[model samples]
Target: MAFTLSIPRKRISASPGQIVTALIIALFLAVFLLIPTGTVIYTAFTEKGTGALTAINFIDFFNTELFRRSFFNSVYVAGMSVVWATVIALPLAVLTTRFDFRGSMIIQTLGFIPLIMPPFVGAVAMQLLFGRNGTVNLLLNDWFGFRIPFMEGLNGVIFVQSLHYFPFILINLSASLRNIDRSMEEAAQNLGSSGFRLFRRIVFPLAMPGYLAGASLVFVKVFDDLATPLLLNVKDMLAPQAYLRVTSVGLTDPMGYVIAVILIVVSIFAMWLSAVAMRGKDYSTVQRGGGGLTKRKLTKRESLVAYATVGFILLLVLSPHIGLLLLSFATVWSYSPLPDGYTVAHYTRVFGESSLYIKNTLIYVSLAGLIDVIVGSAIAYLVLRTKLIGRRWLDWAATSALAIPGVVLGIGYLRTFYNIPLPDGTPLATLWVMLVLALAIRRLPYALRACYAALQQVSISLEEAAENLGATKQRTIRRIVLPLMTGGLLAGFVTSFATAAVELSATLMLIQSNSDAPIAYGLYVFMQSPAGRGPGAALGVIAVILVGLCTFLSHYVIERRQKTLGAAK
Candidate 1:
């Protein structure tokens, strides 16, 4: 018996309400995201005094030795970070997915720890633990008679970024591995393929999409990062050079805009390369009545080696958090493997003196998260439920924020709003709320995807039934749609809030005064001087806790919701 189940495909013009809703979102993107980004691109290509289109800026960029070096250095650092991140992520992904490994769940969960802390927050801690005169080198000199330059120059940035971002690969690759059809593997085995040859020939090729997705992300993130390089005191990178040129030489300098344009180009290039690699290649292998790859059992020796390997990688990745905690409590920690003494004074000082930073961060991030969810939910609804004209453009515009570097967005906001004034004669750009808007814009894509996924899981039949019962679109969404989407909206908010709390690049440019600064900006300021390192470490701990809690909350909500949905079914 053949069962042909056909679903109707139809496109209807949007209702007036949907058109209005889309227009509102379009306006928001145009003003905040599109225009500012366009301004930066325009500034980069135009002649400074004449406002005419010219290629002189780029020609001069290539001609200058320092600028040329910065460009190549950025590329090299980003590329190396991807390589090292893969090295760290690939093994864990395979071990957990391919074998019946003990503590597999624990290892996967711990990988999220590095992401909660910003790369630059860990930069100083890494230096203390790995620098030439630092603890590791001191111990190595005493014991092994030689030291590795783990925290030297550009190596430091690469090390910090790879450790911080490998989870992207681990997560995506693991999901891909879990979805691979076992039938293909069994067929490959029947054909005499086994071991590394089996993995290379059959398994890895199927997972290439996932690997490239993660690797591209790592490359783009490292390339766009500003604070990590600056904190490491490696100033010859493109992002740092852009920041320095704008702040030190003043925004009127053409070099900053030029570098920002180049950053955008390289980012787009990396994504394009990943896409081109996966082009015209079908990776869909899961078939009916077939399951994912079968797990293999490891022998005692293999288990021991696997545990040992996983333990070493975890220690290396978690070192920053460990070092930060020690530094926060330490009275003095230098030229030693551990702190000399510990105290609670750093936390005391943070609460008493720098409490405003925390408060501001909470307020700003909350508002940003709220904005993201509202806007994201609306976009998702419009796209999925309505046949609104140009609805896809809203999705494209929002997701475009991902390609933009934080430093570039900061520069864009400054240029676009610097001269505009409020009722009190203050420049509109100087307002604290602008920082919130930037955060919202920077994180909208994440929230949008979450909401989109949530909305997709909702049956259109439910909404249709409500409409048939005489309910309005707005009323149906408010009563029927929103309640069903609570889980996803909450997840989206948590994600936006967690990541936004640690953002520094955009905040750096948007912050007009110390009073308005968030924790990330405050951390950057405190870490600049030796005397403030303890308090800075304390704030960093607070940030880690804040992001960690949000992450845990997201997971709990998602799991609880899933259980609830299952029970209802």
Candidate 2:
């Protein structure tokens, strides 16, 4: 007879634990991340006293001469930095991935040296080495009768940023080049495509995604950077303007919020453009034998040229580090090729008087890293292991922090929390704990990716086996899953800790007392005065060493774990 009407059953894939965990994460993201960000946007659009929606702020932003110049300067510096960074990176990537170059490992390893030290930390060092009266220029003037404006005005900012950030492009482009299918290159070669023509037509287009990704990152980083411009005394840029407006003009000023909004928009646009550029450009290929581009042997002339180019780039890249080490021990270094004299006194002064900065940094970053890995692991588990509703939003919320400049986050936190008083009557925003929270929020995405990758590598069958053996989800996660994810969690911790140790942007706004200042804030403070430069440089060297050691140890640990796991299997 007649068929009965039937309704589809809803899938109830998440357990109560998963649901509760998801709610907790959502609550944290909402209160800490979403509210602070929304507060900035709300302030940017609304009038100061009336609290009514208005476009006057944005109108003022576009109309003001200073704001207009800052806007253009930011764009120009970001664009040129990306260009120069690409110029520096492209040769290295092509040389290493395509040719059997000597000491390629050393070149690649040294390429990453800039990443450990923040651009701002090296800003003074760069100035000392490349300034008009500094080392390189002095030598050039003595020999060649001319000076390069390498550290003059906006040029200084661009130089420091390009050197610090080219590694991003280098890393991404090199990886992309290495992964390229050799078959396509062979096909191009069969069609008479060779050398530069082959690269332009075949290799680069296929690697465009990686280049775009890195370029976008560099653009966003340079655009959003506050300390580099400020340290270089090049304040005609959006980020420094935002920081100055808030710190000097006060948080109530509409200009800072406007700049913050512009920063966010530009960052999002860069990322979007990168994505759009990459759409429909997938060049992945399946092959029977070997993967990646085939390496070619460099001829005698080519080898000489490659080595010289790489050596020159490396020298320029490392000059800041060399200058820093020299500055740390110098009795006086002004307008000199080398220090007038050297001593361990600066390091002794740093340890004796500025030790609190180091201690605060250790505690704060340790807490922040711990928070990041815990939250990151939770989010990774919720998204990967369960079909929890709104789980993907958690990931999106955390990742959105990438687009928010640290200056904006600091402004948002100050605007949102300064009025809320603690039980002792101090404003909640002024507390040292807020510094740790900001660092955690800033570095959370990196930790989340590490945890997500680690979780992905843990076979689902292992979890299924645990569940089938009568273990609860929570029990299985703790006893089975977390043990396997240890490498990823540790990797995530070290990354968060290392990066957070040097983060000064958001903390600059939150730090209320010298006693509570972390290493980065302390470095900024020391670098501000002429007399403190030696101690500041010493502190920077310490930071570089700390980050470098952590990175090396993380790599070693992850590799050892992989080997052990492979052997057990």
Candidate 3:
């Protein structure tokens, strides 16, 4: 079917469908973020008796010792985490890139294990190994007649979060190191530069941009996260406030709403600054289309040390997985160390009735992926092409959400949309549109990056060529652009989908009573219960397998289809 090239300028009258789409997005933002939160803010100033304006809420937080302490702890712990993560990751990245080392492959791969786990899960695993009555505690007390205090308060939170988030710093710096022109390093070396001198002169300055990016990511992620703090029982964190408001009191708690608003402001500011500092220039320090990973042959002693370092890193990375795996097979559970002899009982329990969570996780993730890829692709196109109005603002708004943190958004939703009437006052509950919207928004950054990167590769001339050939606007996008973007779409889809499946922070805040909770929720619940060992471990294992399967299927289905089509053509 042929169509006319009458694409109207500025969409003189927005199409009914477009209007509906715009209304939906607007409605989501308004209802989920604006209205509910706005209500709380409005009520915050209102008199306690007359329910009118007052400074009570702000004064309450600023004045109260508890709230103030929590605020300080949030800062103290997150700051320490970022600093330590940088300190540890920098040397590792430097070693991997600069010096020849054995087992570099294993080290590089295991460094990223933390990235795959949800933030809270890391805390849970850490607790199992280091908390009171933990595996290490028991072993130390029995053998060494001493037990180390490694959990609770600022110290523990900072230690675990830093360990979990250091990969961002390491990978970023490693790439930067590999990118520096070999000749640059060679010239410095020939000019009496080695080790500390070489570092001070050439590598350090060149790697600054990458270091900054890694550091920025660490800071933003640690500052905004709620999962690790909540799991570790860190008092006075923003996420717990959100949880307390809805759980202990009700949606009417203005205190929670106030915290949510403050968090949003802080997050937005942090994100803006990070973007300016880290992304002032392009990120690819190493030239593209370059040779594969360069190997430097190490001396015998250095090679031995490198192997030792690899073993240490791998042990740290795999400890929790091993602990969880043992827990999964336990009949008695919680006894630690092989579960006092394994049984298939937990597997039976998990594979029996508790399997529902796996299904729920998969469904929620799939829908979120679709939303992310489609909406993100459209947003990317508008920002990159056609010079849409508020394109800059739109770009900022979309990316800025990443800064807002999942827990904050979850609070924003709880404060805004919790218990609101849905369709004919039917008493519609949680797992509604709001929950899904939170997931979509939380994961939108990945989709946006995928689309933005893909769009850059798709030159405007290709679209122009289609336009010149008399293709309709929609048709041109459908026939030309969408097909080329399957890789990015798939990548975005897998990321969003995986995160949604394992989501904890916002889900905990907003999930309703009697709702069919996702796997993360299931795991959290089990971890706290008498039956925690089997269910938590089983569910977590299921989640990992499903995420892997989703990635495989996405690659197999979408990319494979594209390939077959290309071959046929």
Error of 3 at 91 (Å): 3.6
Q: Tens digit of lDDT per residue, candidate 3, span 1-569? A: 99889966774243344445444554644554455445655655666557767777888978978777766666676678878887768767866777776556667777876666666665666666777677888888889899787776666777677877888888888877777766666767788887788788777777777776787778767776766676677757765665676568876677776666666666566556766775555434344532323446788887777667656765765666666666677676353633567777677777786777766666677787888888778767766775434445545656655656566666656544445667766333364555677788778778788788777767789899999999977888899998877777787888789768887877787666425677888878777665565767777777767765665665576567567657867
Model 3 spans with C-alpha error above 4 angstroms: 1-56, 181-191, 200-202, 272-296, 333-336, 423-431, 549-569
Candidate 2 RMSD computed on C-alpha atoms after optimal superposition onto the true structure:
1.5
**Which of 1 and 3 is ahead in lDDT?**
1
* TM-scores for every candidate against the unseen true structure: 0.96, 0.97, 0.85
- Stretches of candidate 1 above 4 Å error? 1-12
lDDT of candidate 1 over 1-569, digit per residue (tens) = 99999998766588888888899999999999999999999999989889899999999999999999999999999999999999999999999999999899999999868998999999899989998878889999999999999989999999999999999999999988988889999999999999999999999998888999999999999999999998888999999998999888987788899999999999999999999999999888768533778899999999999999999999999999998999999999877888899999999999999999999999999999999999999999988987777889999999999999999999999889988998889999889999999999999999999999989988999999999999998898999999999999999999999999999999988898999999999999999988899999999999999999999998898898889889989
* Alpha carbon lDDT at 446, candidate 2: 92
lDDT of 2 by residue, 1-569 (tens): 99988997777589887888888888888877889999899899988789899989999999999999999999999999999999999999999999988898899999999999989999999988999999999999999999999999999999999999999999999988988889999999999999999999999998887899899999999999999999989888998999889989998898899899999999999999999987776666677432889899998998989899999999999888998999999999998899999899999999999999999999999999999999999999999988767789999999999998999999999999999999999999999999898999999999999999999989999989999999988898999999999999999999999999999889888899999999999899999998999999999999999999888877887898789879988
Number of colliding residue pairs in model 3: 7
Best by lDDT: 1
Error of 1 at 374 (Å): 1.0
Model 2 CA deviation exceeding 4 Å by range: 1-5, 288-290
Better of 1 and 2 by lDDT: 1
- At residue 114, candidate 3 shows an lDDT of 65
Least accurate 10 contiguous residues by lDDT in model 1: 284-293
Clashes of 1: 0
